[model samples]
Target: MKPIVRVVRTGTANLASVVASLRRVDAEPVLCADPALLRAADRVVLPGVGALGAAMGTLQGDLGDALRARVEAGRPTLAICLGLQLLLEGSDESPGVPALGLVPGRARRFDGDALRVPQLGWNRVEPDAGCRLLEPGYAYFAHSFYLPDAPEGWAVARTTHGVTYTSALERGPVLACQFHPELSGAWGLGLLARWLEA
Candidate 1:
């Protein structure tokens, strides 16, 4: 049977592209806002595309608790783009708002003075040794805020745009990417496939 991947309905993510990408990998994608489903699904994908505050608002109560429980238990979870940011303690984009705190640190804006603000287009992701799902490839990135350093004890992958930052992180069954794998062509699909296999 195809893996049933429950995708959190963050109200701001590009669900269509994420769903289509999962289908390409032969996984059954279910767009869900229900907290119970999120907690119980075998695999879960958290994809976000808009402001941190807005996404957090949608995830404020039970949905937030379900995600926290899933990640804390080391369940299979993939957090992409803003989803990755949401895993952190907080973000400069929305001050005073607490995130899931699954990973240490907070999201900070990329230095616009050094390079482009929202590092668009494809960039190389150099995976560290021991990473199970990430590979060295050019993944599509579209973000202004980033985690400057990898959280301690997690398998890390770095990418450079203005400054080098953590592009992907993996620990146990939880994987998070600062880039958009769903829109990243073959490399992205391969990443998703690997995640499904895990």
Candidate 2:
């Protein structure tokens, strides 16, 4: 199946990271920001990073409408990092920013003094046993905040970073991850290839 990979297009740095990740998965990523661009593909993949408030603001004001329509249509979709944060109603990290509310719960940092902000490097994200999004290995994560928990029927996979946090989610054909699959090396690329197969 063809996946219409989309980069949020907020900054060059974010776009570069996305480009690198998609190429690793061997998927066709489109540069267009318009919702109509999604019409050409069978699935959607959204990759993002940076501030959640700013990201949600753009999605709400612009891409939000388009994405909502696309995902609701049942075309498979996925999100990574800030892309995952944009899935909720809003984040406690940055108050007042409206989110997609696709999943329940708000986002927050490590919430502990011992743990570092922006937990970097490789981490193991275990699947819920019932979750279909994971294999047996872990995914890469680089972020300060995380989804505490997605409402029932939403959470598909999870990982520990300072604390156990939601790592992946699925609602219908929509699949999202709190980790950066592209940066996870073999595991990440393999995950993308699998998503395409699914």
TM-score for each model: 0.98, 0.88
Candidate 2 global TM-score: 0.88
lDDT of 1: 0.94
User: What lDDT score belongs to each candidate, Candidate 1 first?
Assistant: 0.94, 0.72
Error of 2 at 100 (Å): 1.3
Best by TM-score: 1
Best-performing candidate as measured by lDDT: 1
Candidate 1 Cα misplacement greater than 4 A, ranges: 112-114
Give one digit per residue, the lDDT tens place, for model 1 in 1-198. Answer: 989999998888879999999999999999999999899999999999999999999989899999999999999999999999999999999998999988998999987666987789999999999798899999999999999998997999999887889999999789999999999999999999999988
